[model samples]
Target: MTAGNVVLGLCSYTHDSAAALLVDNVLVGFAEEERLTGDKHTAAFPERAVNWLLDTAGVDPHSVGLVAYNFDGRRYLDALAATEMYAGRDTTRDRAQPRAESFRKVHDRFGSRMADLRDRFRRARVVPVLHHRAHGLYSFASSSYDAAAVLVVDSLGEVQTTTLGSGRRLAGGGCRTTIVEDIADPASLGYAYGAVTEHLGWRRGDEEGTVMALAALGDPTRFRALLREAIPITDGGFSLDPRWFPLRVLAHDYPRVSAGFIAATCPARDPSAQVEAVHADLAAALQERTEQVMVHLARRVRSVTGLRLLCLGGGVAANCVAVGKIVEAGIFDEVHVPPAAGDSGTAIGAALAASLDNTRHLATGVTGRCYLGPAYPRLVLAENPRPGLTAHRPAAPAKHVAMKLAEGHTVGVFSGNLEAGPRALGNRSILASPLLPDVVERLNDTVKFREPFRPFAPVVLASAMADYFTLPQPAPYMSIASGVTDLTRERIPAIVHVNGTARVQTVTADANPFLTEVLTEFAALTGHPVLINTSLNVKGKPICGTPDMALDCLTESGLDALMLEGWWVSKC
Candidate 1:
């Protein structure tokens, strides 16, 4: 491989399809196909994303010295062959065509899809890195520690769903990686969690967050009798009791009718006031139990590696509540979590792992900004303002608008650079007073059109996070959860989730100057450094892409004001 060579990392042909480009070991641009394609959890080839990355970086694919894909086709093929053999040729015959075709298509594309580029440059190499190792790389390499214990948890990364390892910066600026443990087949926390998510009538990969949200509203204790018997932890990992589930259902079928039908037999009540006490207890128990399992795993890693720092990645990292528990336990002095902990980040991981010639790795500070997505120039906004809306350039300036917010005005902010992750950094967010209970309802009904149970997060001045949350570290990416003090929770009830935990994105003056300025103005006026921040989008849509998208939201929703690049518009 070439030193400081450009590499293309693509996680297409599977879930969370995305494209990332690494220029000289630095992540220049990364984006999921779903956002641009407008399909949630898009699993198709990331053609647009790949093209965008090359175009944005002003580099030809031919310039890429290496192309890193997230999985080993040969290993995956072996796993499939084993599954088919075990199922018997007669039974496998019914299921093999589509499965075989999927693998074939990916293989064919990987070999020849970028032929023109290879011809142009001809020096680039295609490298197939194992999926879990890439995941471990993404977490450990991006971490704050020079040496740390790394743990990756996911539904399944190829044949392995979970891996435990140790990673250290080499003495002379290289990286040392070791995999101490691996669990394959039937031993997956993700599968366990996914099973329950399916049992609850959610859309599996897409709706797991919803289950996590809903769990906060119910009693976990009420479901322990049922769940404990269903999912059990063992030396290998976690397992499911056949009484509560059926393994014969294809792994690809998520929350299917068959699964639900099986669940109905082992009854649970629909969410209701009469069942609130039981439901809340059950939710709490499942959350508690999941945390318990994670803690056990963390303890095992610490025991084996004796590392004081820990790094986490994968779909399970999305569980902030569980993450908070791990942090509070004090097992690790420090923990680092990637903002894009899910499959979308695999592209970055794959590229970095494949490009490791000397093994010296450094965590690239969170990409310069989330504004990696397409932008709308002034023309996009001028030509269209949405129906029933008027546009204005502020005469008094954004500082003046900040003054109004400080004085308790609710504002919807949309300006320069849309964020890439699930969290809405300041660019595409609805800013509001955390003190109002009615604000949550209003935002939900008018702007979000989302489940009322969904809660907003607070973007607070980084320096002040400790004053309100039991945070051990500054959470720049809102990657983990922190407890809200009773006093603060009472004051900013709108931002607290049902479980009294908040996924906060701490704003530093250096990282987000404009947002910090607005919050500073608000803090000066109201004596609080936090504002309610929720994604700027309507239900079932991705975050707003343009100023017009922002304006459309403001006029269509019941919001009172819209804040944009140094300007705020209000209805006279």
Candidate 2:
């Protein structure tokens, strides 16, 4: 944990592009490009993100010695090659591109922007970490566990669909991740679910969570057998039948489904069409299959690795329902999923991987994580004050915010450093009283401007989770859903879903003292230590990253109040 040159990590040119910086084996800063660009899930190179991290950490680019990229450039070309084979085209068609065509592809000589890193900073060495390897490293380095079975399931990562690995701490405070088994492409459960998402009439990557929520309203048994047949279970994982998910027709720009799928089930839904009961049933069936396969995969990893702890990452791990099922199955003694489990998190993973290689130890993990982004040490209102809003500083902002929430007001809170991933995590979140009636309805329809079917989660005090939700452990990142107690269901109807489960986020004082105090004060006033929590942004937009953006959202959305740093603001 002592010495390493400054390392920069990049996960760009794909979904959720981001950058992370490590200095002396410690991750000092990380940010997703989508948060700064105003475009949701932009794949642009994260130049601004890297600059911001370097500036925030006060690190000079000239001093950086290594650059870690989250994808083996050659292996990724192989992944792209499968796309050609899947499309039934000659794999050699794009192998030898002309100089100009190849110029667009290469950023440096070592593969994938290594030259660019050197050009931008100095002559830093660029290393291409395998995509799934970065994910496994991130899980192992970030968790408190010394040894764990790691599972990474995503759409595809350099030909790997699902990876089963084991990670253990080395003698010198370092960690090692070893792949025990992996399921490669052509039989991807991630693609199977993505195909199902597109067929359900929603955007594949952007709207899978909506499908997860819609599943709560449907009957899983209606189409369970059909999907089970389409995706047969294997020894450790599952495989998607080529008949149901023809590679030529799967995950492409158009014709999202195969002819066999149309013959076996109905055609893909139109985007503007209604969410009919059949669609709901299909989503439920798909979700059930995903949960079963994930649980099966975790169980197999536990068996093969003989490890009591599990660390899960990748885009598919973002499914809270499936994650909860894995935990409920008790396949391991503990399960840890990073806050940013998706592609954006690869930046951190890549950096940690390099740090382990550079210094033989991971210096940052097990504590002080997820809130490593930019912060407003000063209130943002005074910089670019928005009209029609009255603001004042309060000595006890948490107490004052709790008072407003107790009065059934929807308040948007923006404080501390930004949470690194998709989940808002209280630092950038909207809060509402869960005991109030129609709070969820108004939050969905008016405040968030989202589908009514979408559900809100409860941010409860950590010690109070057992009193409300039937969770076996603390859910610090809102990554898992658990059963709501009978008393909780009756009292906080706003947070309870149709399936009688709530995605609960348990808060501790160290994570966010103000939110913890607010929840504590709200409990003192309302007798319930819970509030409806969701991202502090409208649908189809990334969460606000700057004070100006937060102020704009405060004016545009139907929120009743605002917590701008330590000040409370409301529309005049």
- Model 1: CA > 4 A from native: 1-4, 78-124, 248-282, 358-380, 395-398, 404-410, 546-552, 567-572
Q: Please list the C-alpha lDDT of all candidates, in the order they appear.
A: 0.70, 0.81
Clashes of each: 15, 1
Q: In angstroms, give how far residue 303 of model 2 lies from its true place.
A: 0.7
In the range 235-311, model 2's lDDT, one tens digit per residue, is: 87888766666542222344545676777666778988888888898889999999999999999999899999999
| lDDT tens readout by residue for model 1, 1-572 | 34247888778666778877887776777787876666667878787778888887788766778877787655544345554553455533444555545445555555554453355447677677788888888777766678899888887775677888888877655677778988764456777677656555555676667667777887666667666666687764566554344332234642322344344333444433233444345556667778887877888788888999998888898888788888989999987777677888888888878767524554353333445555444533342354555557666555665676666666777766656567778877878878665877888887687667777788899988887888888787777788888768667777778777889889988877778887888777778888888877676666665665666667767677787664566655
The Cα RMSD in angstroms, rounded to one decimal, for candidate 2 relative to the true structure is: 3.7
Name every residue pair that clashes in candidate 2: 108-115
Best by lDDT: 2
Worst 10 residues of 2 by lDDT: 91-100
Off by over 4 Å in 2: 1-4, 77-112, 248-251, 365-368
TM-score of every candidate: 0.86, 0.93
Looking at model 2, residue 484 earns an lDDT score of 82
